[model samples]
Target: MADYNRWMNERLYDAAATLPEAALFEDRGAFFGSLFATLGHIVAADLIWLNRFVQLPALAELRGPLSALPAPTGLRDRVADSLPMLRERRVQTDVVICDMVRRLEPVHFDEVVRYGNTAGASQAKRFGPLLQHFFNHQTHHRGQASTLLFQAGVDVGVTDLNALIPHEA
Candidate 1:
């Protein structure tokens, strides 16, 4: 799932890069309003989850570095206003995610974590399923971005996870 997340994000960013600046940030009335917002939301949400995941003792080393940037205040925050900056942030976030997953021990998944939602509600859940939600959330918004891009006449090409599967005899 981490690999899929990275792969799809790279594809989306690549496709979005071809568009002129205005089209990228135009409000099309989708959930996040535009391609830029959709991607920004993904990065923001990923940081939220990464911050949660790093709470586990095994991942504590990542906590400080991930804290370097001010945590996003809300999912709707326009975290990055430009393609270049957003793309850079997206890559950096993906690197942190991939590294965090690599260092995770199987036991880490079973541990429960507590976090505050954007709405200020308290919540607790197992780390494993939250990780699933993390990646799935990315796929969901990326799908929206793809549709919006297509509406704007840009194609992200084939996006199936099967494309990454190895062929075997």
Candidate 2:
């Protein structure tokens, strides 16, 4: 899933690069109102979740560059003010996510994580489900981004997960 997330992100950014700066930042009625903003939200959320993940006692010893990174000030805050900056940050964040996932042990999956939401509400949930939400959140916003890209005349080709699946020999 981390590889798929990275693959789609690369494709999305490549397509977005073809767009004019104005079009990239233009409001297109997506949740965050623009492709740039939506992309920013994805990065912000990833950092938030990763920060939370690092806080887990079971995962503390595994902290590295990801934990050293600062958390976003808010859910909707722009981690990067421009497309190029956003793409750079996105690449770095994706690498961190891939590394974090690689380090996880099977036992980590069953452990519960406790964190506060953006609304300041406290919550506790199993680590496995939280990880699912982390990836799902990316896909959900990426869908909005895909729509925005299409409306702007860019098509991200072959988004199906099957594209990543290996065929039996």
Candidate 3:
């Protein structure tokens, strides 16, 4: 999953880098209003989840780049003011996520973590499913980002998970 996340992000950022600054920042009517803003939301959400995950006693030893990142003032806070800065932060965040996943033990997944949602509601759930949501959330926003990219004339080739699967010999 970490590999796939990194692979997709590389493709997305590569295409995004080719886009003109005005086009990338233009309001294209996407959920977050613009491609840059949408990407910022993904980074913010990832940091928020990683911070929550580390709070679990079973995962207390886990730490990475996210620990040093400033908490988003809100879910929609712009973590990066520009596309170049956002891309840099995105790569850093992805590395932290991959590193965290690489260090996870099976027992850690079975533990439940308690944390407050962005809405300020308290919640508790198993770490396994929470991890699923973490990755799924990335894919979700990336889909929106891909659409934004396509509308701006960039092609992010072959996004299917099957592309990463190994075939039998």
What pairs collide in candidate 2?
none
**Residue 16, model 2: Cα distance from true site in angstroms:** 0.5
In order of listing, the candidates' clash counts read 0, 0, 0
- Preferred candidate (lDDT higher): 1 or 2: 2
Q: After superposition, which runs of candidate 1 have C-alpha atoms over 4 Å from their true positions?
A: none
Per-candidate local distance difference test = 0.87, 0.88, 0.87
Candidate 1: worst-modelled 10 consecutive residues by lDDT? 69-78
Q: What is the per-residue lDDT of model 3 for residues 1-169, given as tens digits with 9 covering 90 to 100?
A: 8889888988988999999899888999999999899989999998889889888765566564566675774779888888888888888888888778877889989888898898999999999999999999999999999999999999999998889999989
Residue 1 of model 1, lDDT score = 77
TM-score of 3: 0.93
Sort by TM-score, best first: 1, 2, 3
- Off by more than 4 A, model 2: 67-70
Q: Report the lDDT tens digits of candidate 2 across residue range 111-160.
A: 88888888999999999989999999999998888889999999998887
Top-TM-score structure, candidate number: 1
Q: What is the C-alpha RMSD of each candidate to the true structure, in Å?
A: 1.1, 1.4, 1.4
Any runs in candidate 3 off by more than 4 Å, and if so which?
none
> Could you estimate the TM-score for every candidate?
0.95, 0.94, 0.93
